[model samples]
Target: MMEKMNQDGALETEKSLKRNNVVRERRISGAVAPGAGAVFRSVHAMQSTLALGSSFESDHIWKLGCLDGSSPDTGKGKSQFKSSSITNKVCHGFHLVEGQSGHDMEDYHVAEYRKTKAHVLGLFAIFDGHLGDRVPTYLKDNLFNNILEEPSFWEDPKTAIKNAYRSTDKLILEKSMQLGPGGSTAVTAIVIDGKDLWVANVGDSRAVICRGGVADQLTVDHEPHSERRRIEKQGGFVTTLPGDVPRVNGQLAVARAFGDENLKAHLSSEPDVRQIRIDSSTQFVILASDGLWKVMNNQEAVDMVKHIKDPQAAAKRLTTEALARKSKDDISCIVIRFG
Candidate 1:
């Protein structure tokens, strides 16, 4: 249910020279492009399905860095953040690869709450884009801030998140002229007061938690096959062609996402939200794009990172494993570990 192309999809538009230049021009002059380090080793031909025993090493290990007010336009590289105040007891890391695409549409954000009334909140998210990176970049810059700005965020996180998703998507649609014809899937995790965890997702990007060595998926993958009834009721039909996967209206693979302006009538931007009470049994959470989940199951991914102490290393390891397993899509991941 990840981003895939069909007969009428935007595959060609995604790879057009214009869009590629847009992505490149937005990146900082010296920002590292995808595949920067030993991070991207050659894919093995053994048909390894889960990357169970594979590993990767990189100097991109976790460390404490400045959480300046500046937002790093990490379009196609790696980033990690940890702190003693905002994210007091948590460790985290993230890695991104453009894969075979002309440009990477993936972006992430880790927002540190400062002077917040709620229990020391922190926000983390992964935005997997299709058609263009503008939507994801917009999400990286605005989604969480908009959510936190909601007056009801502290009193009613659920309704706040839902409203935020709708309003944010509306903003994206309103700015379609500037954002271009791209769209994006999102998985957002909000750690409230450090004891409550809230997650919301649209499309296939996902969030999973590791509790006492077991994997529990926090978000559902909204695939066209599962939502065919609703799409049909909305006057849209899911189509499946020989050798090609089923797509919504014979175009988009995901049933929901942000900013598919052309297909907004058929696609839904509302997210499936879940709340979990964090306890001693909770260990860490993984937020990733479909690139990793397409090749590995939740349990497999949790098992791979359960023993890793450094969250940054764990994120890099997960990205490396996906590449080794022959995943041919843009890969990105965020590992958040609680101590």
Candidate 2:
């Protein structure tokens, strides 16, 4: 496996380098207000020039109307839940432009049933992919399912989530040939018992909760500079480019992610988990790729969506705002509102 990885490492590193450049540009450009609705024409053109592979169409792949907390199985792409135990609204949106590959991945499973247990839960996640779409796509399909299958998920969720993350990373490494050399940052939110929320993350994808109209970050970003100690201890180095941000190994910007077999020795898939008890103060939660985060802070995002009423519109506004600010990465987001 090491030998095979060595052969592909060079090519993968080159791809990661390009993606890093895009991220660096976003950082260098300060945050643009949500009202600024002008798309950075040059940035989009640059992204198109660097984009590899076939382009995907931007049709409404799936849509669900206002579901009044009746069904748990409302197909894919959208769902809403409201009951005595929980009152929540969920909405997801994505972007796929011409001449560019849509690499970001997202998934939300509402009222997911347990095989042995009789519990129903909701799972929401956003994955930011670099190099290729394989890693994020795989995570969108498997990560939540794997966490549910951990058996101990109901009793000790933290342990279950941690184990699932490591096991899933192993699976990605073992299947690298089919999954490719790409990697992805992930942020996942699990709502159980209808009143509690558990969030986990790896890399820069983020989860933020709006409590009393104030934004509270649920997960910490795993960037190269933030995890310098861990990286150096693992015999890996983080490098900073002039006028740019720090990157892991001078290649990948994120310090932790799923896949990236060549950097697995230094990188970690172990997620930071946080548990929250929903109350009157908790307005809504936003799980999004870095594209939205690159241009908006926690308060700005919450402020933009607090009065929107519709979760889908809130998510779309966030993504659209990011693009307007010249964000070059694939943007995706999931919004969940609680009563």
Point to the candidate with the largest lDDT.
Answer: 1
Question: Model 2, poorest ten-residue lDDT window?
Answer: 24-33
Could you give candidate 2's per-residue lDDT for residues 16-50 as a string of tens digits?
A: 43442232111000111112222111011112222
lDDT value, residue 223 of candidate 2: 83
TM-score of each: 0.76, 0.73
User: Candidate 2: which stretches are off by over 4 Å?
Assistant: 1-116
Per-candidate count of clashing residue pairs (backbone under 3 Å)? 1, 0
> Which pairs of residues collide in candidate 1?
119-193
The alpha-carbon lDDT assigned to residue 247 of candidate 1 equals 90
Which TM-score value belongs to model 2? 0.73
Residue range 151-194, candidate 1, lDDT tens digits: 89888999999999999999999999888777899999987645
* lDDT of residue 86 for candidate 1: 32
RMSD of each: 9.2, 10.6
